[model samples]
Structures are given as structure tokens and as C-alpha cells.
Target: MNNQQWTGWSSGAQQAEQHYLVEPRYLAGGGNLHHVADFLRASGWSDKSKTGGPLVFDSPDKSVRIGYDPYTQPGGWTISANPADGQEAWHATFTRQTPVEIVAGFTDALTRPRSAHAPNAWGPLQEQRWQTEQGQHFTAMSPDGGAWLQYHQSQPGQALWWAGARNEHGRIWDASFTASTPMHLIESFSAALADPQQVMRPRGHVPPSTRIRTTSVSVRPDELSAWQQARVTAARAATWARASWATTRPRHTTATGPHTQAGGRTRR
Candidate 1:
């Protein structure tokens, strides 16, 4: 399942290592962070870290946060076979197990009857990965028209996904390289699992809708000055244009362009 070739381990090119590439997905979050936490508990992981992160599984061989968290390791989730914590079997433990298991198990749970509510109906339409003063994150939308899911890569192998109310409510799992196969899967998941009504689906089925408009935003009058408002309006227009372009463009885009999500919040 993993195609790892060691063509440049010491050539100052690509570092060679054995890893099971994880596929990212936009999942239905009816129960919020607690839902994701349940997955970790079921998987035999522990959220014992005082770092205010997701649950983790630690052993004699490895130490990895069960889900992904970008805070500690940017660019991806925190997956270290040779952790600095003195875990000797980092390679041995991770060698036999891949991070995909966590993703797969979590996604599988989303398919359950009470999880998504109705049939799958939301997923990633297009994603823009960029960096800001705060950190590196992504802006994802649903192809079928629903909500916006914004996420960030905190660490090398971990990511945190939330809506415009990302931190307002619970968290979701959303991460993967911008150009990887997992990216495609994630896009599909966003479209299939994104709930527009902000209500849990019935039997995990997302409701159908022809009301396909860009998500709306709510800004308090006192939050920005007149000039800032004008700039923000222009930025919103540009973001719409880019999203439109994304529909016809490639599935994965590498743009160092500036992000337009004010305060990193996604509207329903």
C-alpha cells in the first residue's frame, strides 16, 4: 500500500524513510470533538499528554499523538519513529503500523447510522493551503454546497480541522499534503460529509440542496475600520474568483497566495 523508495537518503535531496502515507478526509462531525475522541479511545490510545492535544498511543517503541496535531509538528502530523523521548522501537512499532489506521478507523465511524445522521452528502470540493502570521492552514469547501472546513498543519504529521467556529466548537481531523492522493480523498469526503444545515444528518445521510451559494460571513461593524472593510470585501471577491477557478482547475493547487478567511472562521 505504501510505495517508499530510498533514492536519496544522504544526497541532500529527499529523505528516505518507511511510512504509510495517510489519506485525509472531510468527515461528518455531528458530535464534535467528543466524537473524534471516542475513536481514539476505541483504538486503544490515551490522551495523557499535558500539552492539550489529541489522544496518543505511547509504547516502548514509539510516541505519536493518535490523531494529527499541527501545533507541535508543522507541515504534517507528529509521527516520529525515533522520538526524542527515548523510545527505542520507534521504527519497529511504526514500521508494522501506519497512521492510515487511525484515519481509516475514524472515517469508518463516520459511516455509521447515528454519526453522520443521513447518507453521505458532503466532501472537499477544493482546498487552498497557505501560510499566515499565525500558521499554515487550509480552506476547504463542499462541492455539493454546504459549509466551509478550515484546518491547519500544526506539526509534521498532525493537523487540526475546524469551521469558522473552529475553536468555537469541537475539532475535526483534516490534513494531508496539498498534492498527495489523500488530498483527493479529502476533497471527496468534504463534499460527502459536510452538513450545511448545521444539523446532524439522519441515518448519516446529508440532505440534498440546490441552494449552492458561497458560504456567508458575519462581521460585527466595530470589528474593522472603513478601510479594512473595503480591503476585506476585495479579498472576499478574490477568494470567490479563486474558488471558481478551482472548479475547473486541478484538484490540488499549490498557491502561496494570501488567505481571505477573516479570523480563520468558516461560515455554515
Candidate 2:
């Protein structure tokens, strides 16, 4: 979907607190947001804040949002323990509950290639259909055969597998598979989503150690540019030095010098 529709999905109430973590799915419109807020209010979320917004539930212990944004993308909106200006504020990062099937699929996809019979698809997979065995119907949509859009639909209370694909040619497509264990998947994806860079770590951080770290380092635009340029120059210099060394290195020699002997005797 386009950006506006996507943002609407993010602003929906289904995204309230961390429920989106369990499902990690966004409603297509703002209506879901209202529905979520109403649900929270009915569920006894406090409206006593100065902003009169939903209160944090003790069980989950997280605030819920009750607002909208024009540029928010699906899976991008979040509720904080605090609110701003009598309205729900979205955090730059938030947590989600992981699903089991998604966890299984993600683990499987990473360790093994898709089965020969499985569809080699691309893009985040949406749940449209499923089989009793739990194997889902998937589709790959792309102009280049290198990428596709895919989805996996699982039995109820599962995670929808999702991600963008990359190859030698860069990112080619995004996709997701249905997950049987949603809570786990939500937990895992929420951690990744909160810190996109974490996924690039050699080994993922364990939950006990998954604390969010932030620094307030500030740099002027020019300083940032200079730092980037310095990095580029260093890389170029290293490449050039390696190439020069490769070209200048001496070649291997055979044992044909005076040190060589024909019958165990030195030949000078």
C-alpha cells in the first residue's frame, strides 16, 4: 500500500500498547485505532491523565496511543508510558510479542533454503490462505525473477513471517511467513524493530541482555560529512596499499641456486 494507507494502519488502535507485538499486524485503516482505544477504555484503561488518554495497564505495564499521523508506516506506531499534550505519542521504537510459527520460519529460513517444492517468493507474506497441515500458500511478485512477495497463513494465534530480501543485487523483495508461535516471534521482531541495527549483529542479543542503549552524541552537519569522508579515504588507502603489495611481492623460487645439491653435496 501507499504511505498514507500504511500510516493509517500504524495509527490504528490494534497498535495500542504492545498487542501489535503479539500480532504485529496493522489494520488497514484508522478505524482500527478507534476500535483499539474503545477496547482499552472498556477494559478499564485510565482516562485520568491530564491528556485524558488511556492509562498503562499493570499486567503488561505499557501506555496506549490514541492519535493519528499522516506519515506513519504500518508497524511503525507505538505507545509510550508517557503522553504528550493530552494525546498519545508514538515512540521511535517499540516492542512487540513474537509468534512461534514466525520464530520457526525465521530460524528455518536462516539456516536452510526453502524446500524445492516451496515457492521461492519475495516481500512480506500476508495471511490469505492456509492448509490443515499448516503449510501456507505463498506468492512471489516481482518484475525480476531475483525477488518476490510472499506470505504464510497459519492457524489462529500464530506469527506472520515477514521481511525484505536481499541478494548480490541488493534488496530485491520483502516477505513474511505465518508463524505458529506468535508471542515468541513478536518478542524477537520487536527487539529487532526497535533497533534495526541489532539484526546485523553477529549473534542476536539475549532477552536478559536486550537492554536498549542510547547516546546523546551530537555532531554538526559539516563534522558528520568530514567524518564520513575520512572513513572513505582510509578505505581507499587500504585498498591501494593492498594492491601495491600484491603487485610488488616476490615470486616463488625453485631450489636451483648454489644451495641445491645433486647427491647430498652443495653445488657452488
Among the numbered candidates, top TM-score falls to 1
What's the lDDT for residue 179 in model 2?
Answer: 42
Number of clashes recorded per candidate: 43, 41
Candidate 1 segments exceeding 4 Å error: 1-31, 46-48, 51-64, 67-176, 181-188, 195-268
Those runs of model 2 whose alpha carbons end farther than 4 Å from true positions after fitting are 1-162, 165-217, 255-268
TM-scores, all candidates, are 0.25, 0.21
Best by lDDT: 1
